[model samples]
Target chain A: MSEFFSMGGYGSYIWGSYAITAIAMIALLLATLRSLRNSRIERDQLETVLQARRPRRTKKAPKAS
Target chain B: MHRFAKPSVFLKLTDPLLPWLAGATAILIATGLYFALFASPLDYQQGDTVRIMYLHVPAAWMGLFCYVGMAICGAMSLIWKHPLADICARATAPIGATFTALCLITGSLWGEPMWGTWWVWDARLTSMLILLFLYLGYIALVNAFDDPERGSKAGSALALVGAINVPIVKFSVDWWNTLHQPASIVRMDGPSVDPSMQLPLALMILGFTCYYFVLLILRVRLELNERRIRALQLSGMFDERSDQEAEKANSYDAGHNAEASQ
Candidate 1:
């Protein structure tokens, strides 16, 4: 509603507070997710290298007389 | 439950959850802010200043909620050594502190017009301020020690001590006559607030809760991976040493065979 945005005259202060809070929350969320993604990628790389280094097992043959 | 505490399992479970939680948080916050800002009716008495309550109240609630959450996780970390518990406590601290900070700032913003001043040393505000300090102290103590385990144990003790402050913060208005209004939104009898205003308030609270969960899950995921990386680093070192030993043993065996052949 037009009246809602007008806020009967205190709109700036009230909405300002909400805006700042929301922005802060969003920033925190983004930072957290970004770092999490980086860590996950790093871990995956480590796991892959470790796996590659592991020796592959092969079956051995036996001869009968 | 304890089995899920394994880092690999936690990482896999959280892998899918991270994006979902983040998406949920964004939707909740956008809708909540829309409702809070555009849909809700202005207060009859306090007019627009009452809008400040949307951020202040939910943030205050989360400030308390987060500390309680941290305390429980810290206790679990200390007793059972739940690998994720200490990390949870660590991750939640900054978010809690931010909410507490928001509460104080918005409380000041609300007070300036309504109370004719920015702050008063009233019971409610005083207790809430102390709660903020408690959060900061816990965060500082937890990171002070060189050893992670030592820091965690010490932080756990601080968190337990700080839990006592939560009740004091909640009940301070009732325990004493104060400039701050008593519980208007959450009460045994029912919220004294208008229904029009209540809806937006409820939305904001839900949004804030979702935001907290989003952050918690993301942070915990990072922490679990960090632990895994640490383990991997140690394993890498062990692998290098084992490889060197194997190479040395093979060289020694080859030399012995060659000597026999000669």
Candidate 2:
């Protein structure tokens, strides 16, 4: 309703405050999620490369009884 | 406490907590918004403008709470050299800075209509501005050095010293004549605000607190992964160098054998 939206002529201030709060919160959530994802990818890539570089150990032959 | 100091154990415990905290935050914020917009009665003096208090006050509270939390973590890291404490303190800086910014912006928006001014250098406002600067400074100091340990040490020291501002910000209105009003919700007498208003305010504060935890867990995990990556890379570099040295020695031996046979 227009009445609710108007907030008795204090609509701009009320809406502005809520909007800014929402934006800031959303932005923070997105940034944190993105950073987490990026770091995970980077860690995975590094792990794979390190695994490939690792030297394989050969099995020892059994001794004659 | 010591059990969780290992990042792997900390992650295992907190990974399960993140979804639950995030869910609670969503529910609480929704309920708070409903009450704030529809259920709460308009203030007799400030009218609908008082609605802004639900957002502004909670954010300001969170800003202070996060800073205090960061300072405590800093102290723990400094005294005991707790590995996870400095990471926690580092992770907290940006979240606290965001909340402080939200508080300042919302307060300014609320002020323009109520006080007929966008800003004023009153005791409370100035102290809050200083708090924002402190958070920014802490974040910058933490990342300024090539050695992350040195950066953490410097940042922890700064956080401990800057903690003096937290109490100042809290008591500024009482200490000096300021345009900002004295404490209403937290006081010796009790909350002066109406029960209807208090409900939404409490909900919002709790929602924000849960939200902070959710973000903290995520950021801490990111920091741990970063440290792991750095360690792996360094070890990988050392391995490559040793392999090259072995190859060089073998080639030299082969050439020496050829010269002897000739």
- Report the C-alpha lDDT of model 2 over B210-249, residue by residue, as the tens digit: 9999989988988888888888889888777655666687
Chain B TM-score of all predictions, in order? 0.85, 0.91
- Candidate 2 runs further than 4 Å off: A56-65, B1-5, B245-262
lDDT of 2 at B8: 78
Q: Pick by DockQ: which candidate is best? A: 2
RMSD list, candidates in order: 6.6, 5.3
DockQ for every model comes to: 0.60, 0.77
Give the top-scoring candidate (TM-score). 2
TM-score of each: 0.82, 0.91
Residue B33 in candidate 1, Cα distance off native in Å: 2.3
Give fnat, all candidates.
Answer: 0.70, 0.88
Query: Cα deviation in Å at residue B32, candidate 2?
Result: 0.5
Candidate 1 per-residue lDDT over residues B1-262, each given as its tens digit: 3465686676677778767776776777677777776777767778778879888999999999999999999899988888578889998998998899899988888888788898999988988888888889988997798677898899989998889988888888899999999988668999998888787778778778877887887787777788778888788777765656767877889999999999
Write the residue-wise lDDT of candidate 1 on A1-65 in tens digits. 76767677767667778777868877887888788889989999999987776542111112211
